[model samples]
Target: MEHSDYDVVVVGAGLVGAGVAAALAGTALSIAIVERAPPPPESPAWDTRIYAISPASVRFLESVGVWQALDPARIQPVRRMDVSGDAGSRVVFSAYDAGVAALAHIVESGAIQRALWRRVGAQENAVLVCPARCASLERDGKRWRLGLEDGRSLSAGLVVGADGRDSWVRGHAGIGATLEPYGDSGVVANFATERGHDGTAFQWFRADGILAYLPLPGNNVSVVWSTPEAHARELTALDPDAFAARVAAAGNERLGRLTPLTPAAAFPLAVMEVEHLAVNGLALVGDAAHAVHPLAGQGVNLGFGDARVLAALVREREIFRAPGDPAVMRRYERARREDILAMRLVTHGLQRLFSLPGRLPAAVRNLGLNFTDEVGVLKNLLIRQALG
Candidate 1:
């Protein structure tokens, strides 16, 4: 097998891994990105999988030149968010009130991946290894050597696992993860609305589950309903028109009638926590490190945060310290623990609180929402943290 060396080898060229490569583009370090599949093909049709990119992530993408490459027409700014509880309680947050340009930008997952791929392709010190998989991994003193399925061996000072929930790299490194399945699936689809979204995002926590209407360009919105497995399967099995109508009614027809723009899909929901975010020569990013319930719409944002922080830490490390040094990796893990824990706690707690069958728990949760809505200082604080 041919052998190669790099300062860093990132597994999985998904959004977070590609973002990490992009973030480190101008640095002096050599980088390699290994992916099991080629970059997603460009398409005229909108992707059903969408993400709400936080302002902090926007800055990170902008720094790497990916944000500027995205088509402005395909991006939608979330100016306001209207959240309602099952007991007729509601809380509204406005970007203007938070003194930000927009709460977040709604972007297609494929668009971000494509843009990042383009940047990585042009990066001077980065190489993309498409259709490649890591068959095995071994420690080479302070570095890690990866044996690819294609008969290539690559050694790197650091190995990064951005390979999603079932990370092959994480498993190879012997990192243990605890997974708490939500026993539900997140159903996603896109639709054209009769009335304009006006840059407003809506979310409802009902007895059935949590439903979110994320605005898109023009009279369109992307829907993500986190519901039980049976309900999710039933929703995906519906005819296009019936599915759209069901979704429209679920949101109280807030956006008027709906027409399906993409076929519905469902992914099982779970919260995952790794025993450690980093080891001597390996580090985990994105879903490889942690995964939280998506009810807060912070899953991708957190992944981006991981990329941003890990890249920064590596770049700013002491010159005497190697990238894979245990001390250096520990710092990255330590810096991320609080943020990951906080998100998991919030999302999981909300899910449990709302899932209770009794009327008292429902009333208490709704009352809390109403109380938070009226508290300006508290709401701003929450928005500020989310903006990060």
Candidate 2:
């Protein structure tokens, strides 16, 4: 390979990376995706983990030329969202009330990434480099030089660190982050519900944690339950049938009995906030920028939103300014900082407020839910905010 300096070098070829790469493909810019792993989700199956993508995110993916490549049958649109509290405090959201056909769509994260990569691979100016690991990235005046582990070097006007939490690019670029573990573990699993979900996503606030049921295609749904690490381990370790029954019972048989379709898995829950999103000619996006709890299921959607805003700015500039210029990158950072901060604080507060060891919170929480349910305008406002 030659020492080619592309216009943009994006690290971490996950969904966010693919979005960024595909976004720049429309312009005359040269782009490269650097990753340690190849494409994932060799094929679509019941065992693949999924994500509940928002409508705005779907539109962005469509704009960048990825959504059409995804198999429509494999995706499930969420027509209704039901949220409740353990003490019988409950609130329900309908897409009809928000004047939309669906609240979100649940899709296999790997499949979407693979499909996006397929689109990105077809771009003439975009190069997909596998097993390309970044050793360090340093600012050289107006440009950033990326040194890779394969004993090769390249320089670009902009370097995007989509490398996820513990981003080496962000570290090398001198960006600091504040990370706090919420002492929660997000346990994910897929299941086949006894009855069709009718395109509804359900969530419950229990004493242990927040449990959400996102619809999958047909009679299946994806589950995300957050709780203490010990409880999460105990739950995931349960025999398949027992685990399924426990989940079904916890959710009050909303979709009836569930049979586990995928092995239960758990990842530590945390909220990470980066102090600086841009340094020199490098900027961070996706998990490299921030990671909130999975209760809201907006983590990946937020990353994709970052790609949309940042790329639009680059495409609109139409000047000699590099995509990675500090000024240009700051536009991306500033656009997303408020949204990220709001999500972080909201999720963090709810996790703590619900995790409290008392009855007062439980009582007051249900009241809060009831109040929100009563105020039609506030509920509508929240739906609009989420749409963005």
Candidate 2 regions with alpha-carbon error over 4 angstroms: none
lDDT value for candidate 2?
0.85
The Cα error of candidate 2 at residue 383, in Å, is 1.4
In the range 199-281, model 2's lDDT, one tens digit per residue, is 98999999989999999889998899999999999998999899999999999998899998888999998899888877666
Q: List the lowest-lDDT window of 10 residues for candidate 2.
A: 40-49
* CA deviation > 4 Å runs, candidate 1: 318-321
For every candidate in turn, the CA RMSD to the true structure comes to 1.1, 1.4
Query: Which pairs of residues collide in candidate 1?
Result: none
lDDT of each: 0.92, 0.85
lDDT of 1 by residue, 27-102 (tens): 8888999999976688988888899999998998998899999999999999999999998899999999999999
